[model samples]
Target chain A: MALPPYAGPLETTWYYGFRFLCACIFIFLITPILVIIPLSFNVEPYFTFTEGMLAFDPDSYSLRWYRDFVNNTQWRHSVENSFIIAISSTILATFLGTMAALGLSKSHMPYRSLMMGLLISPMIVPLIISAAGMYFFYSNIGLDQTYLGIILAHTALGTPFVVITVTATLVGFDHSLTRASANLGASPTVTFFKVIMPLILPGVISGALFAFVTSFDEVVVVLFLAGFEQRTIPRQMWSGIREQISPTILAVATILVMFSVVLLAALELLRRRNNRLRGIV
Target chain B: MANEIIGGDVVLAADGTPLKASLNKAMRKNRIRALLLVTPLFLFIVFSFLIPIVEMTFRSVDNWQVGTLMPKTTTALAGWDGKALPDEPVFAALIQDLQAGAKAREIGKVGTRLNYEKSGLRGMITRSGKKSLKVKEGPYKEKILKMHKKWKDLETWTVIKRNTAPYTMGYYLNAVDMKYDKSGEIVMRDENRRIYGKLFLRTFAISMAITLICVMLAYPIAYLLATLPLRYSNLLMIFVLLPFWTSLLVRTTAWIVMLQSQGVLNDLFVFFGLVSDDNRLQLIYNLTGTIVAMTHILLPFMVLPLYSVMKTISPSYMCAALSLGANPMVAFIRVYMPQTLSGIVAGSILVFILSIGYYITPALVGGTDGTLISNQIAYHMQKSLNWGLAGALGALLLSSVLALYLIYNKIVGVDNMRFG
Candidate 1:
């Protein structure tokens, strides 16, 4: 958007002003994320930049917080718990959600919209309500305070992402490919493994990534259902922020930000692959 | 011969099965396959998610604990009139019930259930349970009234009688900031005890404010991205997607670091002589902090949908309108803004719905007055151990969100939802 030579002075002024405003908004969006990266490395216990840091002193920065994050038993336990819950829930959610998505895409499925609504309700319902409901119900069944309870709770929460993403992928899928394989005398299993999997694998993997992230970041349900032994990364961060603000949390946040960067890159690549496969690009 | 040939007419497949029957059979098989594929997840959700929520709703009204704990008293109270305190039989039943409850160590639970309706009953019940063992003779009514003067009040009897039923609306009543007053009429709670209604209103107000701020911040950027060249827009999109991909805890922590009184923002202000070091603004741990952090976190949700919608809108409409003798501002307001209304509505509703149910950002920075209804629900579930009231509040929040979601699905179509 270059200014025309015949443009009035007011139009030019407005154009420059608008761009400046958008620039500020962009700064607002990205600065919070970028600011923490430096603060996470600050040697001072303060959340703000210290005078030494402003003067370009190398002594102002250290890896002690990151080391603390690793060496602390509580943080290590939560990291382990996070991976265990996220990985297990992701597997269960992907399998069940992919199957349900397969079923949903079929023209013969009954009451499709209603079923989709029911499957996606967990995502739409407020987390507090779900946690409250699950607390009373799970406690009654003796499932609360157990690892299995948190995993199952997360599985329920994660399935909606899998269902949505996988179902989106299946929308572009060519159903006749499966029919063609079957007509060539391949078994149903063989057709799925050979013809269908190749096309929808990107969607499945991205959906699995979404499920993994959802389970990894979720805290409210964990707060309600998890015992001390089952605390995850988000749960630990939650308590840390509530009870005390520590630089180690910033270190942990920095690491999680990096983890999300990797996940985001993978998702973007998978999205591009999907679009190319569908000939949209 | 013609009639016989017409009557005998039929279609058949190569396997000698009728075409209609074979088609029906194939359709049935497909339906069964689809059902089979969906059944596992369906049953899993029902058992793990749906049933729990339904049971929570039931728990809100399921007040059988008092009645069950004092079964003999409940049966005796069923025959007594509510005009005055009950006769000796009701008192004897009460004493007998207290002795049994104390022996079982369940009297405290009964007191807690009743205290939600009538205050001060918990202490009365607990005290009476301890002293009931000392009284072993007749004339229990006078003895009970002597033990606790609250026994002489007819309001206590009304509350106990109301809760003795298998089902009660006391929790739901309390959820809306109302309760059953004396004479069994529903009335508003006192000002000091009133919190939920105010919390709900505050939640709505804060969410609306966040939604408005997000739209104001996002509109120009989305418009810029939409109208810009592809290379430039793609480069600038990282600003949006990076935050979208980052952990929520990290963003919130960033805000804490930036907005705290002695944090970077205040430091910058002080360095610039904007304000003296003696009086830094109280920025974090308040409503301002909640609004700023939530708007920052939710801005991506607003921009993505608006950008997607704006991308489909060609620039030629504005060009034509401007060329047709209309000013650029008028042309934009008339032509471009109307086209973007759907996007605005979708983004606003999405952000509003998300903000209303928010727990983390508010819990972190929303000190006392800034906390929303979700925080209160969490407080009840964890701190107060008031499960029934928590369920009632949760049920209300869930329904509002579900209602909005249904409308969202109807208008925008959930299948079109996308993530960056």
Candidate 2:
């Protein structure tokens, strides 16, 4: 907003002061994420920058930490585990969540609020509690320390986002289009594919991205359900941070920051596309 | 429209069904279709998510160790008064149960369970179980008493008798920092052993502190973001969304790199002569580190809601108050602040709920004084192997979280929750 050119000197000072305060808050919000990138490249294996690096000396920075992360077999295995679990869980969450969201958004849906609460409880409940519960139950059923168990847990955790986002997209949907397709003798499956899917695809994709990120970033459940054979990226990073104070974790953190940047940009694009399809933009 | 009756007062479908009946049939089919679609996820959640939590809650009081492993002794102790030691028949039953339990290698489980109630009971039970295997004949009371001094005390019998049931409140009692004294009356645990009570209080206090700090920091930024031009605001929103998108472990790691003694912030402080190099500030691994890191992580939860609410509050309300002779600050407080109260409440509760259950960041950054209840729960689950106590603590924390969640649902409506 433009500052009003009120003649009062006090108002003038307050205007710039307010902006300055907000700028500092913004820096506080972002600085920690930005700080790790430069620290990751430090040659001395310290969290702080070296004098040579501060002076723009090329010799002071190295890719050794990145090399260590790549060369390390456990880190590589964890990356593979993270992807396999995240992808599998995302697919399951999206499929089940989309079907459920479509049903929940219908006016004829019975006990809609109660059903929604039950489905989304996984997201709202504390992770530690969920992990503890799953640990005991999964152990009893012999599912603990298995990839299938962790994947199922992540799917349960991720479906709430899909349900929420897809249902949100469905709110602006026009049911008459589906009725028209039916009137034209198109079957229900054809109508879903030809009419509804195109319109809500952005929301579905956004939901899938959310699911992927949730599973990818999840550690509490992994810590409980996963053994050595099933360690995900976050689980590996946890032990890395706790057992060893190395710049290799900072290197991984820098890579994660960039990865999040990509995810954020994709979500923004989906949000805009969803808004435009609904004619809100 | 198809089901509407004309002036003839009767209508039929193509299949000759009554119009009203056909319409009801169609509606019922639609309802069934919707229900069918939702059933899979509903069942999946019930089995995978809800049942497990219920099982955990049940485990807090599910006592099977003493009763199952020492069945003979449990039955024999039923007739003995808890005020005094038992007779030879009870001792004979105990020796028989102990020999059987030791052969099965399950007496250790019973010992571990009883040790939770009374110190040295684990040693006494296991030691007696091993030695009882060698004692073959009668007059077992004196021999069993001589095997362990704890057997001579009447409290040992009381503990065994108390745990004979299929379910016991011993785990729940321990969780709340209360225990059964020698008289079998519940009393507060000795002062040094009372950890859970202080841990619960500290968890709440830390969460409250983080919530207040988030509000203070998030308000101005959200206000500015909401009121700014669309282009500028879109660019600025990245600062909030990026962190929200980043992995939690990554953020905690970032805080570690930034707050450690030899880290960036301390380096800057030393460079500016704020403190000497020999006396770098201990920012990480304490309460300060937990608060700063958690506030940074949870700030977006505060900002997004407040920003969404503020964006809908038209600027004219503030302008009207200012033009009506109120000072700008007064107008802002009375009009603008009141309008944003819902956002404030929503964000505060969301942050508080999240912070109270936080584990990863606190475990990594928070040292002894800073760890929350969740960390203690994790410790018991992983290290102490006391799943019962963990379940009890989890149930307590879960109940509080569920209570707050209901309030949050009432205020904000979970359907309205959005993610960047």
Candidate 3:
């Protein structure tokens, strides 16, 4: 697995050339995302760079699109429903996925591998198949076309992620801490709530954040199961892209990118803290 | 304490003996509790995910159509051979059998349901024998052939006449675009039936290629973030995660708008003096656009895994190598790269596995040519109403993914890798 050393000019050039390609590609991939923010405030809506043109002007930097996005009834409703569904689904997925991770963490369990595979199977299966399966199952159960219907579906999809994250943190857990708490005369439930919960808090919080983002962004399954009342933001966005024309969508998209950036930064901070606490740094 | 250990007191006996390796025994005993802890997840998955998928999968092989009606004809035709043409009575019976299939809610049902799918089979089956053909009948074989050449084929007769042949591997074979010849052995597809299978492969290959591209792009950025000063790293990290909240539809649309003939990229090209004012590059509605958009969307999948791996590599190891007289590049290649292989492997496997099941990005950006295998499955489920074929394809995709998962585990122990 070792490579020849960069010994002389020929080797250094070869190494630097390969490294340069990597750097160039890495920059190219990141560029498309940054390109949008500037264009959002561009004098022209196009992504072209006009020579000798820079800085935001009231003429070029129009708030009209932003205003339109905020005022549009469909966009507003989608945002509202997206927040509601994401928060609700996050709660359900985090609680269920965390507890399930705990239960599975018990070394005495008989069906662990089989169980882990099943929990993650929802993730592995193609979304459209699950979309079809859920369509049939929910319709038969009389849960179709309802907010709870979408909630349960999203919860099912998101729970595996929670299980994955929490289970990961739990793998780093020290069994002796809980045992010591128990030996000190605290009950098992109290020990879990006080000692274990705090230790795994980052994992659970990150899991919840993931669940929220997933539910917020999910479109295919939502499109399949959601009714007019239950349509989440992604579903609504999909509709606008397909059936409507608007500069408002651009504004809304820009805001969404900013929001994701903020949330993801917070998530990274939590993760880094968790790593520091565990002394993995 | 040594005396106590020899005394076989509560602790000693509970822990077993020096001869027994008590730690090993204790771990052995705890393994079952581990399994028990994980059971509720198992049950939830069985009911919520596995059962539904398995039920759908079983439908692929189940001769549900033949089983439902004319139980007698199902029995009679169970072993009926297609040698010197079907008998006159058997031909009459087939007309009745087709009617019975339609009545049983099997034939002409779901396939042909989606817009993008080619519903060739559904149209043929549903449209068949609506008005019996008045063949010029000097030859009985030619007369039967006049109605349909497909019916003259032996495999078609066997497919229709079989009972609930739960053992039928027909669906499994067709899932990969291979099917049984008249002798009932799997073979490569007929020359005429080439494009559908080729499209599936093209989709799979494109996804794999995109996954590779994403890994190549994301690894360095993840490496920089992992190693760099915290302040700058955080800023870069935010940009990396920025697009997640941006609706994928919006991102995809942005790409479309930029890549289109008269779109932003064209304007940029002209303005930059890279090309003539009017000329535009073909970008959208091709394999390249699909690949670019998908790679953009899934870059995070690669970055997070690579970052986690890189983070665990102690800076001291590289410093140690440099101090030992190795140059920076050599130190990284020999020491750091090997350490980060676990991450690269993990990121590659994760991205590759997810890519195969991709649908929307390809559907939006690739157009007709860019469609992945999943699109075909969706088409079968929705448009063609060929739940059977859809289910078969689903099983095929699942098995391949599972195989890849197993391979990944072997290469880098699954339990060791942190997905975050």
Clashes of each: 0, 0, 26
Give a tens-digit lDDT track for model 2, residues B13-131.
Answer: 76776788888999999999999889999999999999999999899999999889989988898888776788999999999999999999999999999999998999998899999
User: What stretches of model 2 exceed 4 Å from their correct place?
Assistant: B1-14
Supply DockQ values for each candidate: 0.82, 0.89, 0.39
Give the higher-TM-score candidate: 2 or 3: 2
Best by DockQ: 2
What DockQ results for candidate 1? 0.82
In order of appearance, the predictions have TM-scores of 0.97, 0.98, 0.82
Best by TM-score: 2
Fnat of candidates, each listed: 0.80, 0.88, 0.42
**Docking model 1 quality class:** high
List the candidate numbers ranked by DockQ, top first: 2, 1, 3
Q: Any idea what lDDT model 2 has?
A: 0.93
| Candidate 2 lDDT tens digits, A188-229 | 999999999999899899999999999999999999999999
Classified by CAPRI criteria, candidate 2 counts as high
Off by over 4 Å in 1: B1-8
Better of 1 and 3 by lDDT: 1
User: For all candidates listed, what's the TM-score of chain B alone?
Assistant: 0.97, 0.97, 0.77
The CA lDDT at A117 in model 2 is 92
